[model samples]
Target chain A: MLKIIKPGLLTTVQDLGRTGYRHHGVVSSGAMDRNAHRIANWLVGNNESNATLEMTLMGPIIEVQEDALVAITGADLSPTIFGKPIANNRPIFLKKGSIIHFDRMKRGCRAYLAIGGGINVPKVMNSRSTDLRAKLGGYHGRSLVAEDILYIRKYSEHTKHTISHLRNQANQIDDFYQADWSVGRVSKIDNTYPIRVMKGRQFDWFTKESQASLVNKQFRITAASNRMGYRLDGNKLSQLKSQEMISEAVRFGTVQVPSDGNPIVLMADSQTTGGYPKIAEVATVDLSRLAQKKPGDMIDFTWITHKEAEQLLIKQEREMKQLLVGVQLRSYR
Target chain B: MEYKLSPMGDQSILIELGNTIDLATHDIVQHVVTCLDSMDHAWIIEYIPAFTSITVIYDPVQVLEIEANPFKSPYHIVANIIEEQIQQIAVLETKKQRTIEIPVLYGGEYGPDISIVAEHNHLTIEEVISFHTAGEYTVYMIGFAPGFPYIGGLPKRIATPRKTTPRSVTPARSVGIAGEQTGVYSIESPGGWQVIGRTPLELFQPNDPEPTLLQTGDKIKFKSVTKEVYDHLEAKLC
Candidate 1:
């Protein structure tokens, strides 16, 4: 059990998310970074899809009520345990009564925290993840706040032993630190990461200049950003047609350019259907990395054949399987 | 009907079967989905069909296992199966799925934009309500928000464009029209649709056992109700 001492800007519980509800117009409101969410659970010897805490850019300060093992993944927010620093992406064993806090992430926007047994929140529509706009799922269908007590189903004795085994081998650090056990070891692609995008259904709606500028120009993530979408500030796209489209279904990573020509990259909490002529969709594998990008982060979009994106996804998935094997081997300590 | 397939995302493939929005094509899309469900390919987790396109969600790694399953394909197999299966059902399922009549109070304080919609369509408020309620609308899709029904089958007499300036907030149950599509506002949000009426029914209740009142293929008609009846239903819904 853990009690919230200071709930930061925003924190909620999330998992792989509720699927098969798109017909109901519900977005799969889940962890923005599914890979990170799963990896945290995987580290705890739990299924990758287990529900866990989704810490936003600024994270909550939690006090451990029970002696338990925990793991932090995703954004590095300079997490501290018992006023002593802890590393993101590494499993840790905390003594009872220690307080844990995560400062605002310097480079990224969100983080994932996992307890071995997963969260005990009620699942709504086959998901426990919070959808703020819809006001459904998660703890009371809202963000976690001060004094909130989150309970996790107790781990099996074997899981307990396994947690401690890794903890015993973990080097104890004084305070804030980087992860000793880094994420699925495909190193973070550097800042100059050329994001690949596939042409959207209405890619041709824009002029040649708009299309070329989209691929060539460097766009910075705008301040007006949230779970719903990220507004990009770049060279305003010039649309050839000023026509209105019948509202149709939209999905994550969809880049919707309004009549004004500014591109708004819709994310997890985006509307189920949209009328704006979409310019492109960022590939799925890159979505996790895109979620990590903070406001003002510079990005350059590169057009890629769908085949290339699919191949990369297959490669990344294979890499993930290898990471799991590494964790299994290292679990022995 | 011509069909084309494209790899949209890593997990899904898009099947653009048709470009039309008539009754025949709508049945085609639904028919394709029902067929896909029965097939139940091990790799296909879920496939979302909307408007004229169907997105088949599959685990590429599992589906693309050439050694295990000779059919190491998602769209090709889905399309082939749909193409073959569609012929078997010579007559499309035109029978109604669900007939839901929503009780609405038109052109009153509840519907603030009724006058604007009427003016835009060059009809009286009473005529607008009569025209709107007279036609039976078919639920094309449920989207934009939970339970937001994208309904078709509106009479041409009262077809109106959306408001030039969208209001920041429109109350739930606000019935609006945007060109050919008419729908009931499921949630209170900013929108540009021209509101002609307001309904007593809660179109979307996330907590309720029946979250959305209508589904695709459902037939809907807006039945005008008096303010007194509207109050009763609203109070009862709460």
Candidate 2:
């Protein structure tokens, strides 16, 4: 069990997310960076979909009541275990009654901490994720607070074996060098500033000049952004009809341009439906990369064909599995 | 002429079918969604539909299977079959939709904008209430917030525009009109709809057996209620 000694800005419990309820208007409000979350779980031998703690730029100071193995990933936050620094990506043993804290992310916006056996939490709508909009799911359906007791799931044979193997060779992570490894970047994304977007559902609704400007321009994330979506400050994308469109299922990473003409990129906790015209969608593989972005960061869009995006996604998935195996085998060797 | 297919997370496809939401293209998009869903591909975890396009989410491991053995991904295989299926369904006509009756109490405190609606339509407040409750509204689709049905069939006379500034929080069951669309708020949320009244109906109940009272394609009819009745239901809601 872990208790939050200090609850940072907006720490919340999240998992692989709740699905099948999209038709009913529910966003899959889970960890902002899914790859980081899942990798943290894999390092601890937890199921790929296990629920974990998603810390924002500033992380919580947690007190563990039981001996466990944990991994910290994403955002490259410098963390310490009981005043001693810890490693990232690889699993490290935590002694009972030890305190873990994160100073601040030197690079990324969110970090994931996957405790061995994953965090045992109640599931709502087939997901252990927290949907802040609906105030449902994950640890009483809210953000983590001071003195919140997070439970660990009952371990399986695989989990027990993985824990024993990693702990037996715990001497490898003895370095005090905290936050060394920069995660594998989403390869060669368009850095011109406008989030690289393929033209969206209502792309044709806008004039040709707007479409060209959207591709070439650089948009800054606005202060009026949260989990619901990111409000971007750039060229306004006007619709020709200006009709009241029936709200429909809106996916994460969708760029919604409201009547105001500014584009808002929906994130982990965005609404399920919206009336804005979608100008582009963030590729699934790159969304995690997008998720790491902080407010005020500049983004540029580079349009790619559907086939290339799919191939990139499949390649990334394959790399994730390899990352899991590579870490475990390297430690043993 | 716009065709941009992007990945949404790990399990969905975002096909930018077109920009605007019109009947001619919307139906085609829906047909593609239903077709992809009807496929036998196990790798596809889920296929969700939207107004203008569909998101087809599939497992990477499943796609890798086809590449591992080319014989598996032939022309007759399930992966390629969805495109043909969509083409067939697109030409079919739309079917009958579900319709429902909704009782509403207009004017007074529940409907703060009834006067605005009446003044804009050039009708008496009583006439506005009667006309509002008389017509049947069709549920084009359910979106925005949960169970918040977007109904069509609003009279042009009462077609009031949205507030210049949206309210920070519109209470649950607050019925509002936006352009020709009239619907009830399933949850207490921020909205810009020209609210005409409130309903006792629990459109979204998270703890109930059925959370949303209405769905896409469902129809609704509004019937005027008394001040006393509105108070009784509002009291029960809390």
Candidate 3:
């Protein structure tokens, strides 16, 4: 069990997300940085789909109720135990009654914390991801509050072995133990590289200037950004002609331009359908990078072919599989 | 069966049946969705059917494992499969249509905007409710919110524009009209549609195995009921 000592800015349990419910208008609410989430789960010897606690700009202070193996990945929020700094991208063995606190943002905006057996939360609509708007999944369908106690599932065989191995090393230590080797950071959180995008269905409807500016301009993520979308403040993209459109299917990373001309990049919690004119869709490979970006951050966009995007995604998936194998070998050692 | 397929993103393909929203376009959309659902390919994650298009989301890595063509991109491979499947798909006539009757309690505390709708349409509150109930509505799609049905075929006499300022909290089960479309708010949300009545029936049940009461291509009929009936049905739900 893990008790929340202080429930930071925003922390919710998430997996891959609820599938097969979008037709029913259910949003796919999950971890913003899925790559990091998967890494955290893999480090703890859990399936990538296992639910992990997704902490936002701030992170929660958790009190360990039992000796458990865990992993912290994504944003380096400066996690510490017994005033000793803990490293990310590796398996960590926490002693009972240990206080794990995350202080100050060091690099990224969101971090993922995965326990050995995963967070034990009732699945709603086939997922444990917390959909705040619908009040559907996660712990009572909401973010963690102070004093909230979260139960952990029974550890896997690998997790148990890893814990015992780490325990031997931590016998002399007071609070926690970690592996000497690490997965290293997945990707550097830098806004310098342009986020790649493909032209949307309504791309032709936009004016020539607007279409050109889309790739050339640097848009600043507004303060109103959240899990739902990032409202970008940049060059007002105008259309060739004003037209009304029927609501159609939209997805995460869809860049929709409303009547106001300011583009809104849909995120993990975006609605299933939208009537706004979509200008571009960010490539799947860059979605994790975009997720790491905070409000007031500047970002640029670049065009990429669908084939190129798919190739990038396939490459990433291959690397992820290799990393899993590497982690498995390290665990045995 | 003429349609255009484009990438929604790297993982999703958008099938645009037509530009206009009409019965013909809707039929093709439904046919394509039904056909895709029947196939249940391993690579296909999920597909969402909208007014005139369907977005099919698939796994790139899974597609590579299943398909023989290693040279072809996952998007192209999935597109080929969709095109081949859709070409052979005949209109599904065997599936029986379901028309759900929603009992609504009109014009009172439950519907604060009933008077607004009536005034805008130059009709009495009673006339507005009669016209709304008189029309047989078709569920074009379920969207915007969970289980919220976008029912088409609103009577011209009762058609009204959406509120200039949307309510921060439009009560759940409120039957509303915006322009030519009518729908019931399955969940409490901010909405601009002029709500004329309230329903006792639960459209969204999050805990149930089948969460939504309505689905795409389903028919809908609104039957007016008294406050007593509303209270009794509401109590039964609890």
Q: Against the unseen true structure, what C-alpha lDDT does each candidate score?
A: 0.78, 0.72, 0.90
lDDT of 3 by residue, B1-238 (tens): 6899988888998898988878778878888877887786898988888889999989988999988697788888999999998888865542356888999999898888899888888899999989988998778888899998888889899888999999999999999999988999999999999988899998999889999999888878889999999999999998
Reference-based TM-score of each model: 0.90, 0.83, 0.98
**Which one wins on DockQ?**
3
For model 2, give the TM-score of chain B.
Answer: 0.75
lDDT tens per residue, model 2, B63-135: 6675355453221233444445554663554444456777798877888998988888889899888888887
Best by TM-score: 3
Q: Candidate 1 lDDT, tens digit per residue, A60-125?
A: 899888766778888888987655678777667766676887998865788889887888888888
Q: What share of the true interface contacts does each candidate keep?
A: 0.44, 0.35, 0.83
- Best candidate according to lDDT: 3
> In terms of docking quality, how is candidate 3 classified?
high
The alpha-carbon deviation from the true structure for residue A58 of candidate 2, after best TM-score superposition, in angstroms, is 1.5
Of 1 and 2, the candidate ahead on lDDT is: 1
Pairs clashing in candidate 3? none
- lDDT of model 3 at residue A153? 90
lDDT of 2 at A55: 87
